[model samples]
Every structure is written in C-alpha cells, then in structure tokens.
Target: MRTIRRALDLGCDFFDTAESYGPFVNEELLGRALRGRRDDAVVATKFGWEYEGTARGALNSRPEHIREAVDGSLSRLGTDRIDLLHQHRVDLEVPIEDVAGAVGELIAAGKVLHFGLSEAGASTVRRAHEVCPVSVLQTEYSLWERHLEQEILPVIRDLGIGLVPYSPLGRGFLIHRWVEDS
Candidate 1:
C-alpha cells in the first residue's frame, strides 16, 4: 500500500492492472489504495482471461463476456469508468473484430475511455483497429527485444497508435549499448 502511494506521489499516475493478476486481488488493492484519490491516477486494466476462484484459466472475449467483465472490473476497482481498458491477450477462438466491437460498445457507453491491446500480433492489431481505433499497444519490447520493430512498429506508426514497451530496460536496468530509435 505504501509502495503504491509512494509511486503515485512520484508522478507515476499511470497504473496497469489486470483481472487475471491475482485473479482479482490486484485490482482490489489498487481500488482501496486509490479510494479518495481516484482522479490522481490514470488507471488502465485488462480483461479477457477467465478465472476459477483465484486461478487464471483461459481467454474469453466474446461480446457478452466483455460486457460482464467490465462490470466486475468496475466493482473491483470501485471506479465508475476505467480510464483505459485493454484486451489482455488476443483470444484465438474469437474474431478480432468481435472483440474490438465489444470494447467499442463499452467505449460508447462510457465504461471505457480508450482501448488497447497487449501481447497481440501485428495482424491482429491491424484488424482490431478497423472496428475501434486502437490508442496504444502494450507489448514486450525493449533494447534487447526488437521483434516488435520488424512487424508491429510499422503498422502502429501508420495508424498513429502509441507504443508502450513493457520492459523498456529489458531484463537488466542498464542499457550500455546504443540502440537505434527511428
């Protein structure tokens, strides 16, 4: 709790939580922590993974599921609306368009402010954007990790989507080598 408060004090207002994380504990903790200070933080959470009790199971982004998930998340987070909501992973069983449309509906209803993707492939990103403009892509990218550059970067650039490198420092904190950024 103290750590989270300290982080917020340090101007790190952007918080990312997922329903799968702790199978719901993370959001609960964040919710309690941000009680009176909700406006001070920019909360971004993810949905899609199913859970049994505290155990995370499989991906389910079906339209109806998306609707139910947002309500559960809102209750857990104790917020009226999430600042940003992301599809935790691209569900292979569901069409990207359907998933995007579900989230698009949530945005229209004011349940979500913006939508994004995490750990999604290049092609999936492109398809989802057609339904609802993707505001950001939160993927694993860093100095040592450059796979995203070859395929994902070009598309996000063309679409004017933002890139949020998951671990910009890679495994280690230091980036001794000069990496190219274009």
Candidate 2:
C-alpha cells in the first residue's frame, strides 16, 4: 500500500485493477491508496465474473448486471468516474453488442471515460466496436502467446484501436536470468 501511495504521489497517473482480483479487494485497496488524491490518477478496472459463495465463479454480462457492476466498481474504487472500463472476458451468452451498449451508456453518463475489451475474439471485437468505439483491447500477447498476431491484432490495428498487452513478459517466465539459467 505504501509503495502504491508513493507511486501515486510521484506523478503516477495510471492504475489498473480488476473486479476478479481478490473478488474486488484490489479496487478497494486502490481506493484507499488514492483517497484524497483520486483526481490525480487514472483508474482502469475490469468486470466480468463474481465470486460464487466464496469459492467458485460465474459469468455475468447482462445489461442490468453491467450497470450494477459499474456502480459496484465505482463504490469500491471510491471514484466518480473510471478512466477506462474493460469487460474482463467475453460472455458467450450475451451478445457483444449488448455488452458494448451497456458500457456505452456508462460512457455517455460520464461514469467511464473509455471502453475496452479483454480476451475477445476478432468477430466479437468487431461487433462490440460497432456499438461503441473501443479505445483499447487488452490481451495476453508476447513471443510465446503469438496467437493474437494472426487475427485479433490485425482487426484492432485496422480499426485504429490501441492494444494493451498483458503478461508482456510471459508472466515472469521470460526473465533474462531465467532463460540464462535454464
């Protein structure tokens, strides 16, 4: 917490968290860390699943659920507006347009600045973008996870959307020392 606070104090303007992380604990942590300094930072968080009875998970992307999720996220983050809001995963049951439409409403209401999608296939990405401009696409992409380059990357690039690669270092497995030692 002190490290996060110090980073925020030193002109760090961006922070990322997820609803799934600790089942919302991360958002709360960031909220506490940014208490009075909320305006100084841009907070980005993901939404998709909710913990089930303290052990399992389930997908929920219904329009109403999305609204509720945003409200919950707002409360947890202690922020009036989220700098960037991302759908953590694709809900196969719900149409991507509907998901994007829900986020679009939040953007329209000034609750979220930008909309993003994570781990969505190319078709879903196209459909969602049609509903609202996707400012960014977050995915696992590295030398090892090169699947995105074949399809998702081209679609996002063609649409002029930014790509935010998670696990860019292959989740710590790509460290030079690890490769060298191996």
Candidate 3:
C-alpha cells in the first residue's frame, strides 16, 4: 500500500494489473489503494484465462466470458470503467476476431475505454486490429529481450499501435547486472 501511494505521489498514474495475478486480489488491492484517487490514475487490466475457485485454468476468451470477466474486474477495481483492457494472451481455440469484437462491444458500452493485446504475435495483432483497432500492445521488451525488434515491432509500428513493454528492466536482470558491473 505504501509503495502504491508513493508511486502515485511521484506521478506514476498508469497502473497495469491482470485477473490472473492473484486471480483477483491485486485488482481489489488497487481498488482500495486508489479509493479517492481513481480519477488520477489510468488503470489497465487483462482477461483471457478461466478460473476454477482461484485455480487458473486454460485460456478462455469466449465472448461471453469476456463480458463476465470485465464485470468482475470492474467490481473488484471499484471503478465504473477500465481505462485500457487487454486480452492477457492469445487463445488459439477462439478466433482473434471474436476477441476483438467482444472488446469493441465493451468499448461501445463505455465499460472499457480502449482495447489492448498482450503477448500476441504480428498476425494475430493484425487480424484483431482489423476487427477493432488495438490501442496498445503489451509484451516483454527490454535491452535483454529484443526478439520482437525484427518482426513484431515493425508490424505494430506500421499499424500505429502503441507498445507497452511489460518488463522494460528485463525482470530485474538489468538492475542486477548494473550492480554487479558497478
């Protein structure tokens, strides 16, 4: 809680969370932490997994499930709308078009402000965007991880979609490396 408050105090307004994280606890915490400061923050969260009493199951991005997930997230976050909602992962069983369409409906209903995709490939990104524009793409991008530079990066750049690197610090590797070199 103190960490969150301190981040907010320092102007860290963009926050990202996923239903898969703690399966729900994290969103609840953010909701409580942002009690009165909701307007000051841009909350981004994701859905795409099925859960059975907290035990996360396989990918389930069914259109109906997306609706249920958003409702649950909204309640847990204590926010009327999600600033940027993403599909945590690509579900092969479900077509990307369906996923994007579902999110588009949510956007139209004002439940979600923007649509995003996480860990999706270039082709998937293109197809999804064709159905509904993707505002952002989230992936592991850092000095240590640049695999996307060749293909994925170009595709997103051409589409005019923004990138939200999940681990710009290489998941603590860069920090450790810096300290070791020092």
Best model per TM-score:
3
By TM-score, the better pick of 1 and 2 is 2
Superposition TM-score, candidate 3 onto the true structure: 0.95
Colliding residue pairs in candidate 3: none
Error of 3 at 40 (Å): 0.3
Candidate 3 on 1-182: residue-level lDDT in tens?
77888899999999999898898999999999999999989999999999999999999999999999999999999999999999999999999999999999999999999999999999999999999999999999988899899999999999999999978999999888899999
Leading candidate by lDDT: 3
Task: Give the poorly placed runs of model 3, Cα more than 4 Å off.
Answer: 179-182
- Against the reference, the lDDT scores of all candidates come to 0.89, 0.89, 0.95
Assess candidate 3 and give its lDDT. 0.95
Model 2 TM-score, all chains together: 0.92
- Write out the backbone clash pairs for model 2: none
Error of 2 at 141 (Å): 1.0
Q: Provide the clashing-pair count of each candidate structure.
A: 0, 0, 0
Question: Candidate 2 lDDT, tens digit per residue, 1-182?
Answer: 79888897787878989878877888999999999989888899988876664443788888898888899899999989999999999999899999999999999999999999999889999999999999899999887789988888899989999988999887788797688998
Reference-based lDDT, residue 163, model 2: 89
Model 2 local distance difference test score? 0.89
C-alpha RMSD values across all candidates: 4.4, 2.0, 1.3
